[model samples]
Target: MTAMAAEIKKGRKFDQVLDGAREVFMRDGFEGASVDEIARVAGVSKATLYSYFPDKRLLFSEVARLECNRQAEEAMAEFDLSDPVAVVLHEAANRIVRFFLSDFGQQVYRICVAESYRFPELGQRFYASGPALVRERMSAILQPYIDRGELVIEDMDLAADQFGQLCKSDLFVRRLCGISKETSEAEIKRVVTGVVEMFLARYGA
Candidate 1:
């Protein structure tokens, strides 16, 4: 095959591996999932799977990374930092709730938590790619407001962390424990509005 054709084949194989890994991981948890199973599901030979991911651990980690990046992209895409604090906060909070309530989100959270005792690095990676990145993004958006005295935050980083926690805590916990049956649009609006009000009361213009 030509170099370009090889690259295309490699890309397609990677996509297949990711899809299969997600399905296997969600169904069997990290500890029980097998690379052979993933390869079979992906419709690729075990050699092909290994060509893309050396082992199951690397494959699982990549899946988490991709999911986190996808979520971050989605959250950041619609976000308009120039909006009023209330509007930004509302939109951000809604996005947070939506992500946590998603099936993929819940699976990723569970996988990290479940694998943390055996693989601390996976949990660390999850944090770095997921919540930590989100907090950093939030802080950047709020920094200008802080500088302008539109928001009265003494510790912008802490405020950003707290903002994310407040918006995601309830739904995240519920989903983590498998108790959250559904997340309604009305609930999202209420939670976002309430969190925004509380945040503003403490650190708004």
Candidate 2:
């Protein structure tokens, strides 16, 4: 095989390992997942797994980031930055809430919650990789509104965080506590309307 083919194989193996890692991490949680199982599921040797990710924490960090980024991209695909502030925020809130409150998102959050005591740094890493990444994207998305003078914001990061938290609201807590499955389209719109209204009230020009 040519060097180019070898590089392509290596890249494919890297992605396979990441997919296996995500499955194991989601099913077993970070603390319960094993490197051996990850390697087996990935169809790679322990050496390959270690070559790609020296440690489970490193693998988990990247996995979290990738999953969160994937979800954010999916959500952002539906967003319209050129819309009015309320419309833009409403669309964003609906998509974001659906993703963040989905089963996969809850599982990821549960892993962080479960392993936090033993691997506290993992929580920070997860936050920086996942939530913080989305917040940065949100800041970028909101910039156009600011440029057009549709929004008056002192800090984009803070505004992004604020909007995210507002969208989640008590619904996330209720879901975590097993009292809600408020992720239906109607429920999402109901929740997001308030979030969008509140956010625009604060920042709209």
If scored against the real structure, what TM-score would every candidate get?
Answer: 0.79, 0.79
Error of 2 at 26 (Å): 5.4
The prediction achieving the highest lDDT against the true structure is: 2
Checking candidate 2 for backbone clashes, the offending pairs are none
Least well predicted 10-residue stretch by lDDT in candidate 1: 1-10
Give the per-residue lDDT of model 2 (tens digit) for 1-205: 3211121124558998999998888788777789999999889999988776765766877788788888778767877787777777777787778767877677667767876666666677778866787688789789999999888999888899988888778778789889986656677678889998898889988
Number of backbone collisions per candidate: 0, 0
Q: Give lDDT per model, in order.
A: 0.76, 0.78
Write the residue-wise lDDT of candidate 1 on 140-188 in tens digits: 7788778777898888778888888888757668767768778777877
